[model samples]
Each structure stands twice: as C-alpha cells, then as structure tokens.
Target: MRKLQQRLDKIKDNNQAADALAGRRSEVKPESASPVAPERSRGRRRGWLIVLGMVVFGFVFGELALTVQGWSGPDFSDARRVGKATVVSCERRGPIGWGIGYWDQCTADVVWDGGFSGRYAIDRRNFFHADEVGTTVTIGEGAGSRGGGVVFSRPELPHRPAVVALGWGLAVIASIPILLLLGGTFVAARDAIRGVSKR
Candidate 1:
C-alpha cells in the first residue's frame, strides 16, 4: 500500500511539474509570435499592401523616368519646328486591378505646322485643358527627344527640363518614408511567420 501511495505521489508530482512548465511557457511566449490578425486576414492585408506598393512604385518610377528625360533632353532653342498642332486623336486609358480607380492614362497625337507629328502621353490629371480629337494646340518647343518633343498646352504643368529634373529629384525624397513603412511591415510579417514556425 505504501508503494502504491508513493507511485500516486510521483504521478501527481509529474503532473504538477507539467502544469508549472505550461504556465511558464504561456508567460514567456509573446502574443506577437502569431500574426496580428487571422491567417486569412493577414493574407488579404498583405495582398493589398503589395498592390499598393506596386502601384506607388510604378508612379515613382515613371516620375523618375520623366525626370531623367528632362535632364538629358536638349535645349528648347533647337526645336525642329514650332507652330499650331492639330490634335488627330486622343485616347483615355485606365481601369487597373479588376478595373478599379482607372483615372490615369491619356495620350494624344498632334500634327504641327510643318506636318511634323508626334504622340504625347500625359499621366497627370487634366494635362490638357481641351485635349480631344481635332483640337488645335501649340507644339511645345525645347523638349528633347525624351519628351518626343511633345509638351502639354498647360504651361504650369511642364516645367523647364532642369526644373522638371530637379523636382523629381526632390520628390524622390518623400518616397523614403513610404518605402520604410513597407519594408517594416514586410519584416514584421516575416518575423511573425518565422516565430510561429519555431514553435
């Protein structure tokens, strides 16, 4: 009977040790080990974030491309020809990601006095006051080959090549914070996943 009681005591001691260990583990484990949201919710959130990052990156890349073009484009005095340009056609293109928020692409063809013609693409909002087929607009002079010698009729929007380049240079500064935020989120998510895996 004594041996049986001792055996029961040992069993009880083992259970007590296990319970204490479980309590310690609960205290030591961090809530962050798991995702902040459910796995499904996290995946959705990450998908949205990736899309946001990609869209923003595309804009930034385009801006920088324009900036570089402006920087490398030739002086305005060498314009091959300058005069009234008749708009042949204008196309509005948009609808991204399941056709949501498609307010971005516009391109028009302008034929100048010398029969010189070129395509002008404008991503900015309302680049031309009255850009449409058969519209008469003045050809922008001094635009290097980068701009395809095309310029918007709206003067304020098209700055000097140097100024355009400088503006983009400065604009890139603002993207730093956004990039950091994206990077941090990615790192946090990765770490959370890693932590879960370690368990």
Candidate 2:
C-alpha cells in the first residue's frame, strides 16, 4: 500500500509540472507574436523605402553626370565655322547612355548652297519641348566649343557651368533621405536583435 501511495504522489507531481509549463508557454507566445507582427510590418516598409531610394539615386546620378558632360562637351569655340547652318531636321531619339529622357540630334543646313556644300550637326536636350527645326544651329568646324566655361543653355540666362551646381544640389538633397534610411535600418536591426535576445 505504501508503495502504491508513493507512485500516485509521483504521478500527481508530474502533472502539476506539466500544467505549469503549459501555462508559461501560453503566456509567452502571445507576447512574442505581438512583437513579431510589428517587426515584420516595419521590415516591409523599410524594404520599400530602400527600393525607392535606389530608383531616385539612379535617376539623379544619371542626370547629374549628363548635365556635367553637356556643360563640358567638345569645345567648338575655335570652330573653323564652315558657315552658319539652319536646322533642317530635328529628330527625337532615346538616350544612348547615362542620358535622362528624350534627346534631339539636329541636322542643320550648312551654308553649302551659297559656297561649299557640307553638313553640320549639333545636339541638345528637349528641355522646353520646343520645335528647333527652324532654329539656327552653330556648326563647329573642329570638335568642341570651349571658349566659354559654360554653354548658355538659356539664351536669356547667358552661361551655365558644366554640371551645374544644381546637379550637386539634387544629389545632396537625395542623399539626406538615403543616409537616414541606412542609419534607421542599422538601428532597427540592432534593436530587433537585442529584443529577440531578451525574449
């Protein structure tokens, strides 16, 4: 009888321990789940933020590079100026590389009809979306136009430095958000790891 009683007591003790364990697990599971849902939400938002940042970075960087190059393209200031040419044809074509949107290459009528027959070419961005077919385009005799430090993009504005300070300005503006995103990601990850460890 004593042996049987001892066996019953042992069984009772085991049951109590199991119940306690189940209780603890049930309590912990809810708390862990709550935190996890929020973390996953944050992770999703951060992923999208990173994607958007990359797109913006690529666009701004390309424009910045193109603008700078436009400002510094071959100098035609010393051009042998075969003669002034009137824009005969203007066609919009996709950018070959590092170019932003629409680009136009114009074939100008070099004053060959009057003297020597020849053709000249000049290209510019379609900023105002204006028709330049009738516009007079300067044909460079040699290769570049370097007399002026900047080409007057705007007839009214006069001179614009190659890679206008604006490009740097946009880059600086774009960087602030990206830097914040990176720092936020790092901090969030650290905090998340720390939080998990505590659990």
Which candidate leads the pack in TM-score?
A: 2
Write the residue-wise lDDT of candidate 2 on 61-125 in tens digits: 75665655444333445344435567677667665454565666766666632477555455655
Which pairs of residues collide in model 2?
68-163, 74-144, 74-145, 75-144, 75-145, 75-146, 76-144, 76-145, 77-145
What is the per-residue lDDT of model 1 for residues 1-199, given as tens digits with 9 covering 90 to 100? 9999999999999999999999988886465676565887989899888768765775665555444443232343455566554545445534333122333345557666667777766554444433455666554555534666444434334435675566566457646656777787899899999999999
In model 1, what lDDT does residue 108 have? 58
lDDT of each: 0.58, 0.60
Against the hidden true structure, what lDDT does model 1 obtain? 0.58
TM-scores for all candidates?
0.36, 0.49
